[model samples]
Target: MRKILVVEDEDAIREVVALNLRLAGYEVTEAASAEQALAVFSPSAGFDVAVLDIMLPGMNGFSLCETIRRDSASIGIIMLSAKTLETDKIKGLSIGADDYMTKPFSVSELLARVEALVRRVGRQGASSAAPEPDGRMVSGVFVLDQKSRVLYKNGTPIDLTQVEFQIMELFFANPGVALVREKILEGVWGENYFGDVKIVDVNIRRLRMKIEDEPSAPKHILTVWGYGYRWNA
Candidate 1:
């Protein structure tokens, strides 16, 4: 069974989510606060996913997400927020979350999203081998190492969030392909995702900042004028 860490300050919500996750066959670990969650979390514990609420006492969810990300790059993170603003979701993705969901969300949808995230993580864990003979893809000055899940710009490593890494991997895997917004959404955020497409645009901008010397005029991962984005390299 896949292990899941659920951190929510609201007792009712935490219990409900944990019960449902347990019913769905996940080994659920619950924490009422970020401090408690960290106490239970160890690098060797092997948690497959983390479900964190944005409005937590003491340490906020974004900070906790970043902390966990620093320890494990491969674990899936889903940020839960009561705010519906696009900026809030973008902030979650910008940190390290692989997916985001707002409050008043359906239990069925939550379960489906969790399952999807687990499956995606599983695929990444299974395919850690080099995608190319050299285990890296060189396009222009950017080099992407599949095994390390790291991007290099002229031999210098560029830090990327989990979502950013997945987006880069997709672009490298299908060079010269014009991926539409919906396609990119399904590719990075999983098919069960029902959030705003603007999230994709937000991430694209973030990716450009890291990979493009001039983010204002990106050469790779170009915008295709109302259609979508295409990877030039």
Candidate 2:
């Protein structure tokens, strides 16, 4: 059975979210704040997903999300924020969230995202070894291990979120393909994904920050003006 951690301070909101998730057949653990969330968190606890509210008592959700992401790359993270600012959403994604939702969001949509993220995270942990010939692919200074779902630059491992790794997989597979944003969205987030297309750009920016020496003038992931992005190996 899949397990979920829902962290929200408001009693009504937390109860509603938890009840809905439970009705959907997911075993959920509830936490009122960041501290409570941490107390319930265990690296060995095998939590498949965490829903964090951006505003929380003491440690904020951003801080908690970072800590959880840093600890386990395979665990799926979704951030909840009432703030509708683009920057806030970007900040959540930049820090490590796989998805972000605004308040009054559809319960159905959140459940769908959680399900999609579970599949993604499952893919990363599907295999343990890569003895296959095509399991490892090299693109310029970076080597992406498909089996391990990890990227290394000059032999040093680079941390990647589940979505980021999938994006890298697509990019490395087609080094100079000049894939359009829609293609990227389909490849990474699937055809039925319910979200804005600009998420591709946000993730691409995050990748540049990690893999490129200068993110402002990226040497690898190049923009194609009005088209999309092409991986420059």
Candidate 3:
């Protein structure tokens, strides 16, 4: 069974989320705060997803997400917030979350995002274990090592989140193709995803920070204004 951690301070909301997740057949663990989560979360425990609320009493969800992500890049993270501001969404994604959902969201939507994240995490994990017959794909200064799931830039390995890694895979596979935002979204987040399409934009921004010489003026991951983005390599 896939394991999930749900950290929400509100009892009712947490209970509802946990109940639905359990009913959906996930191995669910609940925490009322980030402190509680810290006590229980273990990378080796093999948690596939973490659903964290931003308004915790202490050590907010953003911090918890960062801590967990620093330890396990493969684990999928989803952030919850009552605020729908684009900056909040960007900050959450920049920190480490693979997905974000604002409050007043339906349980069904949350479940769908969790399901999509879990599938992505599983697929990425499986792919990392086996080396492709052609081990690496070289693009300028970048070297994507399929077996280790690591991207090397000029001999230095650039750390990539699971989502960013998948995006890189898609870009490398379709070089010079002007991929629309929806196509990128479906390619990385899967077709069953229920989150906003802007997620593609946020993740691309984050990925550029890691890979590009200057994120403010990206050269490789060029934006095709009025449409989408294309990998220049």
> Residue 166's C-alpha lDDT in candidate 3?
87
TM-score of 1: 0.88
**Candidate-wise lDDT, in order:** 0.85, 0.87, 0.89
Q: Is candidate 1 or candidate 2 better by TM-score?
A: 2
The digit string of per-residue lDDT tens for model 3 on 80-116 reads 9999899999899888999999999999989999999
Local accuracy of candidate 2 as per-residue lDDT tens digits, 76-169: 8999999999999989888888889999899889989888877777766333233248778777888887767789999999988888888888
Candidate order by TM-score, highest to lowest?
3, 2, 1
Model 1 worst lDDT window (10 residues) = 123-132
Output the number of the lDDT-best candidate. 3
Look at candidate 2 and tell me the lDDT of residue 202: 87
* lDDT, residue 13, candidate 1: 93
Whole-model lDDT for model 1 versus the true structure? 0.85
> Higher lDDT: candidate 1 or 3?
3
